[model samples]
Target: MQIYNFSKDNGKKIGIFNSNFIMSRIIETNKGAHIGCMYLEENGIIGYHQATIPQLLLILDGEGYVCDEKKEYFKVRSGDSIFWEKNEWHETKTETGLTAIVIESEELNPSLYMPKKHWDVSSVSF
Candidate 1:
């Protein structure tokens, strides 16, 4: 049982992310549960990616869009939370910028996947 504060931790640009963004990790554990705050600058793209465990991104501020492997795209804003099932491929798009809290399991056995060669962005909207 521990209390983690987002504002207390200093953020750093993670190299693993293809996008130009920074994240501040609130909890770094050896077992389950990891939390962090991520910020993406304008026109930044997280790129289609996958996670090992289930992930939930709680939008804290700004706005953005999320798309799944099926090209299912949707808008997200502050206070909204999006969930990605284990190993689910997804991507984020931001025209202005975005800030959100990312939560996932620390014992992640991630298996990344390649994105589809072709897709229509206007295929889905919400």
Candidate 2:
């Protein structure tokens, strides 16, 4: 089994317009699992994006609002976990700096359900 230290992982900026959000890949497929950590600055927005595999977001600190294509929103904070279905459009609104761990499967194939032209952010691969 592979292990990862999220605190030691260096986060990289993946978005073109908003660079305040940082993402660090903790574990990769080569390690037998996929995991990562995301840190969003206060007022930072990740914009609409979707993933290939269903993911679980476990909030570690601060608070934020998660929204999807339906415009539905949910308040999240430390100890809260949210599950995002594959191919669903989603975004985040962080009121305070938000830190979270995201777990997904690398074995799953990903397809962008949303049009590329509609994406205001950039996609980063680990």
Candidate 3:
């Protein structure tokens, strides 16, 4: 697993006409992609399981913890994104609730577009 920042701090300002706003590019895929929003209520947990395909989780609000095959939890917050390779074991849980957008596809390549954040986790390998 890897973490990336997609906050406004990393976005580009768009000034079209007289409007001004920041836009953060998420992903662009020519092939079909699976996208969905996840709403985990307080004290919720998404049980550990192997990813069926390359997956990216973009935290939209609140905070939560994600664990890999090693079961070591990593704290994540809004604007933070997590990536997992296909068949990688992972799980997500929260004590104070969290919301995120999940993107899955075989062509997902975040490293090519987003800047990766160094995680304190000992190693991504399990």
lDDT of each: 0.63, 0.58, 0.88
The deviation in Å at residue 8 for candidate 2 is: 24
Look at candidate 2 and tell me the lDDT of residue 86: 74
Between candidates 2 and 3, name the one with more favorable lDDT.
3
Residue range 57-125, candidate 3, lDDT tens digits: 999999988888888888889989999999999999899999999999998988766788767655422
Position 49, candidate 2: lDDT: 86
* Model 3: CA > 4 A from native: 119-126
Ranking of models by lDDT: 3, 1, 2
For TM-score, candidate 1 versus 3, the one ahead is 3
Clashes of 1: 0
Candidates 1 and 2 compared: the better one by lDDT is: 1
How many clashes in each candidate?
Answer: 0, 0, 0
Query: Where is the poorest 10-residue window by lDDT in model 2?
Result: 109-118
Better of 2 and 3 by TM-score: 3
- Over 53-82, each residue of candidate 1 has an lDDT whose tens digit, in order, gives 777676678888888777677766664556
